[model samples]
Target: MTTTPPPTAGAIDCDIHPSVPSIEALLPYMADHWRDTIVQRGVHDLETIAYPKNAPLTARPDWRPAKGLPAADVATVQAQALDPFATSIAICNCLYGVQLLMSEDIAAAFANAVNQWMAAEFLDRDPRLRASIVIPTQNTEMAVAEIERWADDKRFVSVLMLVMDENPLGRRLYWPIYAAAARHGLPICVHAGSAYKHPVTSVGWPSYYTEDYAAQSPAFHNMVSSFICEGVFAKYPDLTVVLAESGFTWLPAHLWRLTKFWRGLRAEIPWVDRTPTEIARDHFRLTLQPVDAPPTAADFERLMEHMGSDEMLLFSTDYPHHQFDGNAVLPEGLSPALARKIMVDNPKNTYPRLQ
Candidate 1:
């Protein structure tokens, strides 16, 4: 047998989802009343749910678990993602608070189960693994409580939020969660996923997954714009937000348009002390994967130039999802230093636990 080489300078995957099949496994550890609701929703098998044809492809073609390691086992995860460049993997759960429209109680319970399981199983088993604590945005109090409970766990590096929540992320209703995140020095990761109760985009439902995929950047732009204009970033300076799975190309144009609008409307929101672009540059980071346009390296470089900061771009392989392409999709011609920052340093800075 030939010997395989050890991993090179470690890379940290800033975005990935290691899905769990059933909420039942977690139920035994969850609060009593919440178990019934989790079982009813069939929270298990969430990964199998098909995206509407309009949704953008996000999974890898052969992305599934090895035959028998526990779903949360680190060894199983290594089998799926252990690459020479990847030293650590940060996962975001699939069936978290996106179900809030179903029932606040059910959403809150599911959030609790996912967090508890992640902390006790995955995080506990692997020092290199990290997770985002899912919280029910529909109920800020419970969300804050969950954040506070998991805040100190080094492995729980951030709070995961669905992009299409009822209230724009900037609303006061969501401040409690931000406050909790800030208090604990954790960032918030907003990912685009099934918007069960909320519409996927303002442009109306798309006819195919490709259309839906194309619309994700806009959805993210809108939410990020809301947070900036509403003074979310101004109020909580230390708080950082990651826009995951949405390609980076649209950011420059979105920031330009938002800044222009903010300039004209600045007087209306006296608390927003900076331009939308400035706030975005300083406080937000975005993961790069499933790039929607300019599939070529030259085009990607131009996109990054427009994005303004290399630090703001993080490497991600939306692993196991059909659209992921391991390392093949990372833009070509990136300098080793710049590539290292996107693959490792940037994430280390954003998710402090990795440090």
Candidate 2:
């Protein structure tokens, strides 16, 4: 049999999702009690869950069937990996974290199952495949346990969390997870999804998928702001956080407003020692994809200029998510060097395991 070559030396896809039937795929690897719960309750559809008592409003659901798995063979991924322009692919699984609202115990079990399965089935299968470890934020102890359990595995690159809940990212409850990531030298990546329990907007359910798509950035902004105001970056100086799925354009304006407010009301958040922009610029990285309509080179340039560091903005196709357009959304006239950095170098640097 002919062997498939590894991805080119310069390419790395920071965001990719390996589809799974449901949480059941990992049942055999789960503990007896957890496996029983999975078999009994079956998988909960995250979009249908209610918000935790004190959590934020639920995000609107413009439902679509889960993009479970692709029909393409391993050779297809190998082709993309080996494409001279592509280097490695880091796959982020969805349902894993979105299932958190189901029940704390089940959520954690689901997370453990998914991580172990991904580690065994995907990452173990391909040296080029890197994955995010999902945890159930609803139960911090279980979440921390799973983080500690897998932090040493090089195949696991980051801890994935959803942007929901009113609690600040810097809360003491989350510190253990941060410590685990710091111990492993892995970044924590936050993605938007059902936030099923926490909706930041008051639009009374968007009418269409496009509206929901548009709302993701604002919700992300709110979550990011909560993290900053709560001094998450300040509290966990060594930990890196990546805000994925939300585009980068709003960042500059939000930072400006936040810093201005902070300058006037420093007393409110005395723990925040550095300006919001500095904290964001230094500790946070963001993924770029689903670039807003009328894509223009100038817009991309402006966003890059505002972010102040090309390295902080990573490329993500949000592959198999339908909204993604491979390579085409990149603005015309973007230099190969910049393209290379956005597509691969930045992600590799942020998630060093990819290297």
Candidate 3:
């Protein structure tokens, strides 16, 4: 593999994983009531299914921190991700296992712990670092409360949610969450992961990790469709939706298919006045990590051209999660002009809170 170059100065990393060092680390941040409840309830850790701690894909060997999970501690992140990448601003997408909890109360407790932990441990430590406000989607009121709590923190860039959430994300039930995000000028970041309420596929649960991995693109496909059809863009015109660690190559075709059917079905969803592709191009921004394009540079170039717009792609290394080997984080053969946009311009544009 040709070595990808280091990032230029002033580049903003749209996605970086800062692992929860431990459940114990969050206790300091948790409300005493919740902390006591958690300990009394026998809960210890909040781990995400999207990244199994032991999986090779979770972290490249060299990027792994010396003593903890990849990117778990601030020092490891500084050495392995921020310093090496020369990041001017890096947004943390902490995908802790708050979603997996059976009780909304417990999930909200952990979510609070996670966000508080982020502020003190990561954002406060590094001026260049910003974070998404992780919320417990099992409860919308609680999720919006999370947004309200962190809205004033410029370092808290967006509200984080899983793509494979319980409902099709566009439903009315989820609108309040988007409303809050828009009110605060923060985008809703949808990462590739599941709440595991339903099988990732329409058919059912798959047998292996490969099946789960491949299923995520389809979840993104559905997310876009649900957002557009349910009038999310129409409802919150200024709201932006950031897709982290989601493949950009699939979007052009998915939007094309949606647009094709939308013209015929416009009357059914009267609120969806515009074409689906138009809504996507305007409202959605996807991360550049796990570009998932074909190996050939020519094919990758073709895919970019097919995407037909530069605004939708944002630079992301998906820190410590081995999307690519070493410094080869940027996709190969991208023109320098496009590279600049992907790295610096697009991210700044997508996240209004990023200064």
Candidate 4:
């Protein structure tokens, strides 16, 4: 299989995963009580099924470690993701199972520990590293508090929330989290994963991991529509929402369908004053990886034309994940100007802290 070359020098990678080596790694960051609780209960690592250990999609073969987890340390990320891509800044969107805890208190505790672990183990060790503040979406008050807790740390470029949560992202219950993110000049990075509160697909649970993984695009459609139809952009005009690891190829078609329905159902959502496509262009940005493009470069350019904006795609290696082969993080057929936007300009604009 052929691959395109790495992105331009000094690219800003918008999505890279830094796995927690183990629950033991986070013990230092957690309170004594929580640590004791974990030990006493014999709690296992928070790794989720979203990225199974042997799954090719979870880690590129060369990037995987012989023991323990891939991207488990700062050095590995520097060598594999940052250095190879010539990343000026790379945002770590750790996808541990902090959101899976049923107890809001435990979820919040783990979330805090994860952020602290990120700072000490990753960001503090690498000047080029930035992170998303992972929050427990199970509790809005706690989620906002987590955002506030890390807002002053400019290394945190965004707030991370799973795409599949207790409820659709657009509901008023989730607005406080959005408000906190906007107020702190942090973008909301809605990444592809599930809290497992519901089935990954609308048609109940899928039979295979591939089915669950493929379902992420449609899930993103639900999220984008929820944000628009629920008037999230109207209320948070300055907010930016980065859809990390969500493929961009499906967007133009999805927005076309949404805008068509909105034209007829305008009265149902009065606050959505503009077309869904326009709203998405203004407030939504998507990471560029797992480029699910058509067969040819010409086809990709045409797809870009349909997307209607050059400013919406941020470059991402997706780190240890097997989104692409070798150092060919970018897809072919991109104009130099468009490549520049994806690698640098668009990410800097979308992530306030990056600027």
TM-scores for the candidates: 0.88, 0.83, 0.96, 0.98
Model 3 per-residue lDDT tens digits across residues 64-109: 7667778887888888888888888999999888887878998888
- Model 2 spans with C-alpha error above 4 angstroms: 1-9, 42-85
Mark the regions of model 1 whose C-alpha exceeds 4 Å error after superposition: 1-9, 36-58, 65-73, 83-85, 94-98, 293-295, 324-326
lDDT (C-alpha, whole model) for all candidates? 0.71, 0.66, 0.88, 0.93
Error of 3 at 320 (Å): 0.9
Residue runs of model 4 more than 4 Å from their true location after superposition: 1-7
User: Which lDDT tens digits does candidate 4 get at residues 240-346?
Assistant: 99999999999999999999999999999999998999999999999998789899989998999999999999999888889888777778889898999999999
Sort by TM-score, top down from the best: 4, 3, 1, 2
Runs in model 3 deviating more than 4 A are 1-5
Which order, best to worst by lDDT?
4, 3, 1, 2
lDDT of 1 by residue, 219-265 (tens): 78888888987888778999999888877778899999988988898
Best by TM-score: 4
What are the per-residue Cα lDDT tens digits for candidate 2 across 253-307? 8899989999999899998888988888887888766455336777666666776
RMSD of each: 3.2, 5.8, 2.5, 2.6
